[model samples]
Target: LAKTTQPISMDSYEGQEVNITCSHNNIATNDYITWYQQFPSQGPRFIIQGYKTKVTNEVASLFIPADRKSSTLSLPRVSLSDTAVYYCLVGVLSGGAQKLVFGQGTRLTINP
Candidate 1:
């Protein structure tokens, strides 16, 4: 399946909750939704992953509805340091191997 659409850049003040939505209309049943965060001069770091329902981690939470065609990445109480690019990846993992494709991600800028 193709990667989801790239959302527009978002701006938020510190101490706010941010939710970025990703659309994968043709997502396959085997596909899993994964979110990543990237900072300047650094590689993308995994934020959360889910096949359906919801998945939460220390950094972020991923929400996938029953259809699994779209997902949202939720960040709570973001700070200025949270300003970065966020990506939503779709892929199928099998037998310890994964093939994930990414499109242009959303740029989230947290202001003071």
Candidate 2:
């Protein structure tokens, strides 16, 4: 299984864009990479998922390379409300169960 590492924290100003990158050099064949976002007192919400190439939604974009060793999350025009912890996870879904283990995430602080 692949393990991920990211910065412990980051700082950004409101209306600026932010990009958080995670490194996972040993991703497994059955594993699918996913990203999540969590506020102060809330559970992490699914942001995006991708096996390879790019996947984008309203909130973020995920980019994966051919080696699958790393991925990047891009948030455009972030705001103060966007301050939160971002997690990168790798696992497989089985029997309709999504069991994921989250690593120590990147804490993003959006400044005014």
Candidate 3:
């Protein structure tokens, strides 16, 4: 199950909420949905993770449906500094280890 899809880029004004959606139509039952945010020249930072329904963190909120086929990462009141590449990933436990496959990330640009 490697099929994942996301928008290439998005533009938003500061102080607005930003939501990035990812599609994983072939997602497995045991897989978990995770999101990561990366700034220029910096490693990706974990945002949130969820298996179903909704999970909220200080930085973002993750929403996964009961079908588990897709997820959305929502950033509240984003600022210019929040501009970054957001990655959606599916992780599964395999052979006593965690395996994650990532898809093309969405580049979010927060404007003034």
Provide the lowest-lDDT 10-residue window in model 1. 91-100
Candidate 2 lDDT (Cα, 0 to 1) = 0.84
Question: How good is model 3 by TM-score?
Answer: 0.89
What TM-score, computed on C-alpha atoms, does each candidate reach? 0.87, 0.86, 0.89
Q: Candidate 1 on 1-112: residue-level lDDT in tens? A: 4557768699999999999999877665687888888999999998888999988988888889998878999999999989999998886444456566675799999999
**lDDT values, one for every candidate:** 0.85, 0.84, 0.87
Query: What's the CA error at residue 49 for candidate 1, in Å?
Result: 0.6
TM-score of 2: 0.86
Clashes of each: 0, 0, 0
Sort all candidates by TM-score, best to worst. 3, 1, 2
Cα RMSD, each candidate: 3.6, 3.8, 2.7
Tell me the tens digit of each residue's lDDT in model 3 across 18-112.
Answer: 99999887666687888988998999998898989999989999988888888999999999999999999986445666567686999999999
Per residue, candidate 2 scores C-alpha lDDT tens digits across 9-101 of 999998888999988765665678899999988999999999998988998889999888888999999999989999999753445554565
Please give the lDDT score at residue 44 for candidate 1: 97
**Model 2 alpha-carbon miss at residue 76, Å:** 0.5
